[model samples]
Target chain A: MKVAQILKTCTRRAVLAAGLALGSAVSATAEEVFVYNWADYFPPELFDKFTEETGIRVRLDVYQSNEELAAKLQAGGTGYDVIVPGDYMVQQLAQQGLLQEIDFKTLENFPNVEGPLKFPVFDPERLYSAPYLHGSTGISYDSEKVGELEESWSVFFDPDPALSGQIVALDDELEMYKAAAMYLDIDYCTEDPAEATRILELLEAQKPHLLMYSSGGSIERMAAREVPMHHHWANGPFRVREEAPSWRMLFPKEGVNLWADNFAIPVGAQNVEGAKAFINFMLEPENIAAATNFNGYANSIPASRDFIDESVVNDRGIYPGEDIETRYVGNRLCSVEARDLRNRVWTRVRS
Target chain B: MSNRSAHSYLAIGLPLLALAFLFFGPLLAILAASFTERAPNGGIDWSGPVFDAYTALFYTPDLFGELEPNRAFLSAFSRSLYLATCTTLICLVAAIPMAIYISRRSERTKTLLLLLITIPFWANLLARNYAWILILRANGLLDSALQSIWPGFEGTGLLYSETAILIGLVYSFLPFMVLPIFASAERFDWDLVSASRDLGASVSRTYGKVVLPLLTPGILAGSILVFIPSMGNFITPQLLGGGQDFMLGNLIALQFGASRNWAHGAAIAVGLMIGISLVLLCLRRLGPKGPHLSGGA
Candidate 1:
C-alpha cells in the first residue's frame, strides 16, 4: 500500500509538470496572426519571410472558393485576423461590418499601388481592402481544335445541333447568368424576373451544346482536350497555357468579366497590428512579384510589375488592351433585387 | 443479477441519450429551418411557417437553364437509386463466389483471406479513387497496356464515365457484401447439400434450393448496407463520374455550398430520408415470414 501511494504521488507530480509546461507554451504563442486566403494565392516562401521579419507567428489557412471563405467569416467560427475576399464580396463584407477600415498611412508601399486598384468600386477611398490580384473571366479554347478564333460567347452557347456536347461552361450560377445577360445585351445586374427568365431560356437553348459545367479546373480539362472550348477564368487558362501552348485565352467579343481579390482585416481580429504588418509586407515589390508569378494571376501592386517579367506584365490577356478594357465590366455586389434575380436564375439553371 | 442488469441498462442508455441529444438535436434544428423562409442575407428568415421550400421542388422551369438535365434533385435521386440498385446487383454477383470460396477455406487460410479482403480499407478512400483514375485514364496504365497489345487500338476514355463510377461503387462496397455472405456460408450445413446430391438432385438444383435460401440473410444484409450509402454518396460520383454524373448527394451539397440555401438542402435531405424509409418498409414487408429464416435474410 505504501509503495503504491509513493508511485501515485510521483505520477501526480509528472502530470502537474507537463500541464504547467503546456500552459506556458500556450501563453507564449498567444499572440498569433491568423490569415485565411485562397489556395495557391500566396507563395509558401512568404510565410518564412513574414515570420522572419515580424517575429510574429503567422498561421495561414487556405480556401478553394470565395464562397467558402465568405461562409467561414459569416458563420463567425474562424477568428481570422486577415482574409482575402474577392471585389464584390469585399464590399458585401465591409457593408455588413465584418471588416475593419484600413489606415492607408500605415502602408509604407501604398504609393506604389497601381492607379486601377487605388480607387476600386468596392472600396472607393481604399477604406477596408487593398487589391491583391485581378483577372478576367472569358472563353478559353484549344486553338488547334477550331481553326479560326470564335470571338463570340455564342460559339459555346451555339443552338446548332452540330455543336451539341462539344462545349463546356462555368458551373458558377452568377457568372453563367451574367454571361447570358451580356450575350443578350441586357443589363448584367437586371432585377427583372423576365430578364432572369430570358437568361434561363438562353441557357436552356445552349444546354444541348454543353458537355459539362466546371469551375476553377475547367482549363485543365480544355488542355487535356476533354472539351474543345470552355468558359474559364483568365488566370486558369494562362497557367494551363504554360504547359499546353496550343491553348488560348480569349476575350469574347461580347464582353469579359473583371474580378479582383483584396486583402482586409476582419472586424474582431485579435492581432490587428500584426495583420496590417503582414499586408504591408505582402505589398512589397519583390514579395508581390513572387506571389503573382506563383499564382499566375495579375497583382495590383504597380511596384511589383517592375519586378515581374515584361512579357507577363504587358500580356494583353493579363493586362487587357484599352479596347478590351472598355468591354470588360467589374462585377459589383448587386442590390437585393438583383441578388434575388441572380439566385432565381441560378436555381433555374441548376434545376 | 437484477442490479447488474439495471446498471448495464443505465450505462448503455446514458451514452445513447447523450448521442441523441448531440446528433439528433442539431438535425431537428435543420429540419425546423427547412420549413421556414430563408432570410435575404442568407439566414433563416423565421418570419412564419411556410411551404415555399417544398413548393420550390416542383419549379421545373429552372431545369432548362445552364443546369444539366441530369443535375436536378429529382434526376439525381433517380440516378442514385438506379446506381445503388446496379451496385447491389454487382455486389451480389461478385460476393457469392468469393464468399463461398472464403467459407470453404481452412481455418488459417480463411483468416488470411478475410484479412486480405479488409486490407484495402486501411488506405484512404480518396487515395483509392485516385488510384482508379491512374489505372483508368486515357494516358493511364490500362491505356498504355492496350496500346502495346494492339498498335491501332483507339481509346474509349472511360475514366470519367458512368461505367467508371459503377466500378468504383462496386469495388468499395464489395467487401461489405462479402463479409456477411461469408458469415452465412461458413455456418451453412454442408451435409444438406450432400444429402440432396445423394438423393439424385442435380448440383445446380441442390445448390439453388439449399444454399441460396441459407445465404439470403447475408445477401439481404449486404445489399441494404451497400445500397443505403451508395444512394446518398457524393464523392464517388464527383471524382469518378465527374460533373456530368450529378447525384442527389451532389445536388444537396451544392445547395449547402454555392447556393447557400440550407432550407432547400434540408428539404431535399428530408425527401431522401423519406424515400429511404419507404424502401426499408417495402423491404421489411417482403421479408421472409418464418422464424427459420434469419433476420437479415
Candidate 2:
C-alpha cells in the first residue's frame, strides 16, 4: 500500500510537469510565422532565405483548394499568419471578414507590381491581398504524338477518333464549365438553364474521350507522355517541356482561364508582423523571380522578367503575346441560382 | 453490494456519456442539418426546417422551369450499389477456399499466412491504388508483359475502366472476408464432417449440410464489413475508374465540395445510414441464431 501510494504521487507529478512543458512550447512563438499555401507553390529554400534575411522562422502547411482554405478560416482559430487564396476567393474571404486589411502600399517593393495586376478586380484598392503567381489554363499536347494540331478547344471537346481516350481535363467544375462556355461563345454564370444544358451536352459528348478529370500530378503525367493531349494550366506545360522538348502549350482560340493566387493575412494571426515582413520580402523582383524560376509560374512584378530564365520569359505559352493577352477570361463568382443550375448540370454530366 | 453497484453505475455511465458526446452528437447534428437550408455561400442556414434537399434528390427544375424526374443521383446510387455488390460477391468467392486452407494449417503456419494476407495493409491505400495505376496503364507492367509474347499488343485498356475499379475494390476488401470465415472455420467441428461421411452422406451433402451452415454467421458479418464501406468508397473509383463512373459517395462529396450544398450532402449521408441500418436489420433476422456476428476487419 505504501509503495502504491508513492507510485501514484510520482505519476501525478510527472503528468503535471509534462503538461507545463507542452503549455510553454505552444506559447513560445515569438519569431515564427505560419503560412498556409497550395502544395508545391513555393520552394522550401525561399523560407530558409526569408529566415536568413529576417530573424523570423517560417512554418508552412499546404492545402489542395481555396474552398478548403476558406472553410478552415471560417471555422475560426486557424492560427495561420499567411494564406494564399485564388482570385475570386480573395474577395469572398474579405467580404466574409476572414482576412485582415494589410496596407500593401506601405511596403517598399509594392510599386514593382505590374500596372494591370496592381488594381485587380478581386482586391481593387489592394488593401487586403497581393498577387503571388499568375497563370492561364489551356491545352497541352506532345508534338511528336499529335503532329502540331490546331490551337483550338475543339481538339479536346470534339476530339478525333484516333485521339479518343487520350485526353484529360481539370476536375474543377467551374473551370471546365468556363472552358466549355468559351468554346461555345456563351456567357458564363448565366441564370439561363438552357445555357447550362448546352454546357452539359458539350461535356457529355467529350467524356468518352477523356481519360480522367484530374488536376493533380499534371507535370508528371505530361512528362511521361501518358496522355497525348491534356487540358492543363500554363505552368505545367513549361515543366513538361523541360523533360520532353517536343511538348507544346497552346493558348486555344477560345478564351482561357486567367487566374492569380494572392497572399493575405487571415484574422487571428499570431505573427502579423512576421507575415507582413514575409509579404514585403516576396515582393522584390529578384526574390519573386526566383519563385517563378522554380515553380514555372509567372510573377506579377513586370521587372522580374529580366531575372527569369530566357526560355521561360521568351516562351509564348508562359508569357503570351498582345494578341493572346486580350483573350484572357477571368473567373467570376456566380449567383446562387446560376450556381445551383450548374451543379445540377455537373451531376448530370458526371452521372 | 451497494458500494459495488455504485461503482458499476460509474463505469457504465461515464462510457455511455462519452459515446453520446463523441458518436451520437455528430450523428444528431448531421440529421438536423439535413432538414435545414443551405445558405447562399455554403454552410448551413439555421432559419429553415425544409425538405427541399430530399425532394431535390428525385426531382429537378429543368431549363424550362418545369419539374422533371432527375435520374442523376439515382443512377449514381444504383452504380454504387452495383459496384459494392460485385465487390462483396467477389470477395466472398475468393476468400472461402483460402480461409479453409489457412484454418487447417498448423498454428505457426496459420499465423504466418494471416500475416501475409494482411501485408498489403501496411502500405497506405492511396499509394497502393497509385501502384495499381502504374501496373495497369498503357505500356505498363501488364501491357509490357503481353507485348513480350504478342508484339501487336499496344495497350492494356485496363486503367480507367470499370474492370480496373472492380479489381481495386476486391483487392482492398478481400482481407475483410478472409479473417471472419477463418475465425468460424477454426471453431468448426471436423468430427461432424467425418461422422456425416460415415453415415453415408455424399461429398457435396456432407460439406453443404455440415460446413456452410456453421460458416453463415461469419460470412454474413464479412459481407456487411465489405459491403458497407465499399458503398461509401470514392477513392478507388476516382483513381481507377477516372471519376467518370460516378458513385453515391462521390455524388455526396461533390455536394459538399464544388457544389457547395451541405444540406444535400447531409441528407444523402443520412439516407445512406438509414439504408445500411435496414440492411443490417434484415440480415440479423435471416442469419442463424447463435453467434454474435460482429463486424470488423
Candidate 3:
C-alpha cells in the first residue's frame, strides 16, 4: 500500500478511538480526565483497564522532559487534569501555584504507598502530589568494554586514556554536578563559591574522557556500541539489557542520584473528580505493577512489590540495599544562586 | 500613463503593506524582546531592560577551556559563519554550471529542467533530512559503496558531521541560486563575445570580459537568497552536525527550548539580522559596476 493510504487509515483509527473515548466520558457523567505524563511512563493497557473498571475515560498526553511540561503548564496551553513531575519540579510547580492540593479522602490506597515515598522535601506533608515512579542515575557500561567494574565515579570522570572518546555523560546540570559533588563527598546543592569552583574544575578535567553529553536516547546509543559507557537513568539501561544483556548497570560507590516522579492535579483542571478517580485507580497495586514492569522502573507503591516479579523487586539495581540508600541523595530544588551556577557550568560543558 | 502608474502603485503597495504587517512587525517584536531581562526561573521578565543576558553569554567559560576561551557565544557564531560561507560557495559552484546548461537549452528543455529541480520541494524538509540519514548512516548505501570500492575500508559515519551539514544546506538552497543565475545567463548576448573574438582576443579572455560581467546580477541575487537562510538555519546543523557541533541557530533555539529565555533568543536573532545587513551593504559597495545587458537585449 502507498504511504498516504497507510497514514489515512492510521489517522482514521485514531479519530474513531478518540470519538469513542469522548462518548464514554460524556455518558459516564464522571468528569473527563486529561493526563500529561512522561513518554511511555504508563502501560497503554492501563488506560483501557481504568476505563473498563470505572466509567471515566482518560485522555493522555506525553512530554519528553520536565522542563518542557513545566513550560507548557506555565504558558497555560495544556489543560492537564494530572501532571507527573520529578521531585525537584514538584516544589517548583507548587511554588508557582500550578498544582492543586490533593484530597487524601479521595485516595483510598494512599496509605499503601511506602513511607519513604512520603514527606519528600519537594512535597512535605503530601499536600500536592503522590509518588509515581522512583529511579537513580548511575553508570551503565558494556561488560566486554570495561571489565570488572569498580564502583568509584573515577572510572567515568578520570578514565584511562584508552577509554577516551568512548564515554557519554548525562546532559542535565543537576545530575552532572551532583555526581561531581558525590565524588568529593561534599553537599550536592552547596551555596559555597569555593565548592562550586571545585565542581567546575572537576567537570573540566573530565571533559577529555567524554565522547559527548546527551540526555535523550544516550542509553540506546550505549546499547548500539556507539559509546561503551554512559551516565544513564536506571530504567533506560535496564530496558537496553533486556535487548542486549551484555550491557550492565552499576551504582557508583561514591553515590547515585535518586529521583522520584509524582502525579499531581494541576490547579486549573476541569475534571477534578475524574482526575481523582484516575489517580486512585493508578495507585492500586496491580496497575502500578503493570506500569513498573512495562517501563522497567521501580514502582513508588510498596503494595506493588506483591504483584511484581520477585527477581525485579529483589534486584539490587532496582531496589538498592541500605548501604546504597545511605549513599543515595534525592535531588533537592536548588536555590537561585546554585541553580545559576549549575546552568553556567552546564553551558560551559556543552559548549 | 496616469492609469498605468496608479495600477503599478496598487500592485506593489498592497503586497508591501501586507509584508510589513505580517513579517516586519513580528521581527520588531523580537528585537524588543532582546532588550528585556530573563526572569530568575527561565521566563522573560519584561519588567525592565538589561544587558545581563548578553554579558552573561560572554562570561560563560569555554568547552573544556581548551583553545577557544570564550566558547559559548564565539564558537557558535564562528561555526554558523563557517557553515554559511561553505554553503554559499558550494551553491555558487554548482548553480553556475547547471544554470548555464539550462539557459543554453531550448525553451521546452529549460522548462523540463526547472520542473525536475523543483520535484524535491514536494517532500517536507524533515523527510529530506531523514532520507539523507538513511543514505549516510553506518552500514548505509554510501558506506556499502565505499567498502566495495576499497577492501578493508572502515567507513567514517559522516551522517552527523559538518560535511553532512554542508551537503544538506547546499541541497536545500541550490534552486535559489540556480533560478536567478539562469535568468541572467539566458539573456546573454552572443554578439558581444563574437565581436571580442573577432577583435583577436583569446577565447578565455573574451568569455571572461564579456560573459562573466553579465552574470553579476544573478550571482548577487542568488548569494543573498542562499546566504540569508543558511546563516540562520537550525535543523540542518542540529540533525547533521550532532549536538556537539553547536551553531548560532541551535544556541538561539536553546534559549527558547530548555533555557526558557526568550529575550536572549531574540537578542541573538537581532544580532544575526544586523550581521546579514552589514554583509549585504559591504557586497553592494564592493560589487562590479556594469551596464544592464538586458536593456540592450
Taking all chains together, the TM-score of candidate 3 against the true structure is 0.85
- DockQ of each candidate relative to the true complex: 0.27, 0.50, 0.30
lDDT of all predictions: 0.75, 0.83, 0.77
Q: Which stretches of candidate 3 lie over 4 Å from their true place?
A: A1-30, A103-106, A309-326, B1-25, B54-71, B106-116, B130-141, B157-161, B189-203, B287-297
Q: Pick the winner on lDDT between candidates 1 and 3.
A: 3
Q: What digit string (tens of lDDT, one per residue) describes model 3 on residues B83-175?
A: 899899989999988988998899999999999988888998866875776677666788889999998888766866788889989998899
**Rank order by lDDT, top first?**
2, 3, 1
A234-291 per-residue lDDT for model 1 (tens digits): 7655666666667777887888888888889988888888898888888788888888
Model 2 docking tier (incorrect/acceptable/medium/high): medium
Model 1, B229-269: lDDT tens digits are 88888767766775566777887787777767778878888
Residue-level lDDT for B40 in candidate 1? 61
Off by over 4 Å in 1: A1-30, A103-108, A159-166, A216-227, A314-316, B1-18, B47-49, B58-71, B289-297
Model 2 Cα lDDT, one tens digit per residue, A212-298: 887665666788888888888876667866687777878888898898888999999998989999999999998999989887788
Q: Proportion of native contacts in model 2?
A: 0.66
Best by DockQ: 2
Query: How does residue B135 of candidate 2 score in lDDT?
Result: 90
C-alpha lDDT of candidate 3 relative to the true structure? 0.77
